[model samples]
Target: MSSLPINPPPRLLMGPGPINADPRVLRAMSAQLIGQYDPAMTDYMTETQALYRQVWATTNEATLLVDGTSRAGIEAAIVSLVKPGDRVLVPVFGRFGHLLVEIAERAGADVHTIETEWGQVFPVSVIANAIARVKPRLLAVVYGDTATTMNQPLDELGEICARHGALFYTDATASLGGNDFAMDAWGLDAATAGLQKCLSGPSGSAPISLSERAVAVIRGRTKVEAGIALETDEASPDVIRSNYFDLGQILDYWGPRRLNHHTEATSMLYGARECARIILAEGRQAVIDRHALAGLAMLAGVQGLGLQVFGDVTHKMNNVVAVEIPAGIDGDRARAALLADFGVEIGTSFGPLAGRVWRIGTMGYNARKDAVLTTLAALENVLRRGGVRAGTSGAGVDAALEVYEG
Candidate 1:
């Protein structure tokens, strides 16, 4: 292949995730690389931990970054805390909930799940009743499932877990920073999130926080790596199976000890740190409010285009909206047209929702009035070109503008 400079097309990512990264985050990622053991790198790590504590609305000392995608954080939190033969209860509201089940099972957890319809969320009572019967060691669920655009209510579930003596874990990859999530206030034992969504950064780093209870469980399963092991270090039978995903080791690396783990992805650390810094500088709640406002505009815009919003609207996430594909247009075709003709990229659904709905996100750096209006205009034009029978000439844009102006 001939060598060519990498110049990509401009795309407004109005999709579920991996949205447009904030320019500041991009700049941060471009900074000069430094050794992992450098004082500057350690200081950046410490500052990142502090920033994420504010972002996650927690004061937990165990908050740190996992050097992988959001799922890596999920796996780390699961595998470290859950030993083989432990029972893990998962309430499946959408795709990510099933992901938790898969991860837990891989960790040798005896996973049991109660599932609701794809577009709906499980009520607290239902999960509580399941916990009552199953008496699981850990309760895992997704805070937001982008596939269905639903935000699972977790506030009450923590107390329910407390009542049942179960550890509470939530994968907040899709919802963190864009939606209302209080890790400490909600009594969450473990919570993991990615930088992509409302954090306005790439997906390489996962910011995770663990309550003391969760940390204690992970410590029990700690095994110092063979290469770094001291003569006095003892290995336990219940040690975490994966060295790479071991939270105990990761904690040591992130904590004051500064023990070497994997050579930290320096660029991703810069990006993650910058993401948290941007959120904190903007004020966490203010960013969430911005996402909420943008989401409402998108929702109204789609509705004005005479499209039906999917799922329970009250339970929908503040970052993405699912709209039913109009009767006469192809969902994928419309999305492709939006991308090719307008340089705007929307998302299609998964599992049961495939071919039935389109997922448009107003998240990260793209969660703004202009992005929402531009996407809505492009979508309406595409639908009309595809011979859709519903929307008027300026209906979508008007609706969205009204939201912004109101």
Candidate 2:
């Protein structure tokens, strides 16, 4: 079989995730690699943790990366924290909500998920009631779900968890850098995120932070090694359950003593660090404001073009907009034309809502007026080509221009 070379097309990623990475992050990743235990490399690790502290809005000394995707960090936090037969309550308002329940269950927790309609979020009353009734040991939820472009209202829920004495955990993979997230202020015990989304970096690293309370719980379960505990003899446990993912020893390894865990993904660490650096340098509130304004532009443009929106507008994710696929417009065909003809890549929905919604993401470096306007224009053209008598011509671009100018 004739195989093709690795060269690929340059298409704007206006999709749900794996959005366009910033050029600075890419450059950082391209720099020289080093040994995991090297002094210079460990310096980067420390700096990376510090940078993530700013991103996550936490002073957690244990803030660090797990060497995998977003799900890995979620699993590490859930499995490591919850003991067998622990009662965990999960809120299922979107696809990621289901993920929280699944992860907790697999870790031997007795998981009970309270589900609402896919496009909606759990009311604070419902969450409080669930907690009062179930009295779960932990509460796992998602901040934003890319599947439906919805952001759960977490402030009140976090307060409820605290009042009920249940540790709160969130997967902020799809919205961490793209929107507002206050780990400490919002009373989160543990939170997980990936570099692939708004962080505008590669997918190999998961940034995670644990509260002091969370650390106490995990530390309470630790079994001291008999050999290692003795001063005269030294031996580590059998690679910590799963060597690559174990975060217990990882904390010590990354801590002041410079112990050894898995060989951290050096390139990805560079990218993740640079990602947080950019966000911190830009300022967290400013970043969130930028995403808000630019996202609103995209939303208005899509609406101006006569495309319907999916989900409640009030609770939608700041960086991703979900628009309904109109009649007579072949969703797949329009997506193809947008990519091949216009060099843009918007997203499609999944599961029960498949073939109905087109997810347009304004994330990372791409969450700007220019990118938003360009995508709106390209999508409008594709819609016109696909037998839709819509798109206010250049109106979408005009509105975006106003946002950019202001």
Candidate 3:
């Protein structure tokens, strides 16, 4: 086999996630690596935490990065705060919601779930009623499920959880930077998100925030790693199940104590830090507005092409749109043609929506007028080639252009 230096072809990623990384983030990742314990590295870690505080819109002192992907952050939050036999309430509106239930169950929680149909989001009243009945220790849900492109309303759910005496948690991996998220105002006890979606970075690090109440729960189950334990180190009777995902020890590493847990991933730290810097520099609200504008344009373009959208558009996320596969066209083949001919990529459905819908995203660095118009133009060409009559010639691009003009 022949080997060569990594040089991948240019691709316009219009998929639901892992969108193109911001060039600034890529450049940051290319910097020279430093020892994890070095003063410079520790300083970068602290600065990154501060930056993410602004991103999450919270003053939580427990905000930090989880070494692995976004799921690692979710696992850390669930396993550290949820103990065996504890009751957990999960509302499943999409695939990610089921993931929360699975992670909680694997951590030995007695998980109870309430589910809505694939395209619909749960109403605040229904979730409130479930909380009152289950009265679980924690209420875990997904803020945005890419599987459905639905943004679950979190503003009111926080108050509901507080009234019912339950810790509120959400996975904002798909919605954090691109959507309106107010952690403190919304009364979220804990939140976790990935960098790939709207943060404009690669998918290796997770930014997480924990309220004091959530921190207290994790502390109760804390256990000091034996390798770094002193004679006086205290271990909680109910130690967390996973060593690597333990928030208590991770906090120590990021906290003033500067204890060692796992070796920090330096390049990912650089990428994550730059991602936050980019968000704040652009103004978080402005970035979210950009995503909203792009999403609207994409929607209008698809509708102009005479394509019926999937799910409840009213609850759709600002970063992605789901369009129904037109009648008499092979959904996968069309997507394949778009990629092969136009160097563009979109997403396919999962589970129930499989073979029924296509997901196109406008997120992060790619959430712009140019990206939206290009993707719509490519899609229109592909559909027309497949014999699906779009309205008039160039209707899709014209429709998207109208959005930008307005």
Q: Pick the candidate with the highest lDDT.
A: 3
Cα lDDT of model 3 by residue, 1-406, tens digit: 9899899888999999889999999999999999998899999999999999999999999999999999999999999989888899999999899899999999989999999999999999999999999999999999999999999999998888888889999999999999999999999999999999999999999999999999998876776653354344354336687889999999988999887888999999999999999999999999999999999999999999999998999999999999999999999899999999999999997899999899999999999899999999999899989999999999999999999999
Per-candidate local distance difference test: 0.92, 0.85, 0.93
Writing each residue's lDDT as its tens digit, candidate 1 over 1-406 gives 8999999899999999889999999999999999898999999999999999999999999999999999899999999999889999999988888899999999889999999999899988899999999999999999999999999999998898998899999999999999999998899999999999989999899999999999999877786643365444354448688889999999989989887788899999999999999998998989999999999999999999999999999999999999999897878878888999999998998899989999999998999999999998888888888998557798999998999899
Which ranking of candidates, highest lDDT first? 3, 1, 2
User: Residue 262 error for model 2, in Å?
Assistant: 0.6
Cα lDDT tens digits for candidate 2, 66-183: 8889989998888777877889999888788888888787777899888888788888898899999999999998999999999998887778888889999999999998888899
What's the lDDT of the predicted structure labeled candidate 1? 0.92
- RMSDs, each prediction? 1.6, 3.3, 1.7
Q: Candidate 2 clashing pairs?
A: none
lDDT value for candidate 3? 0.93
Query: On a 0 to 100 scale, what is the lDDT of residue 77 in model 1?
Result: 95
| TM-scores for the candidates | 0.97, 0.93, 0.97
Worst lDDT run of 10 residues, candidate 2, spans 230-239
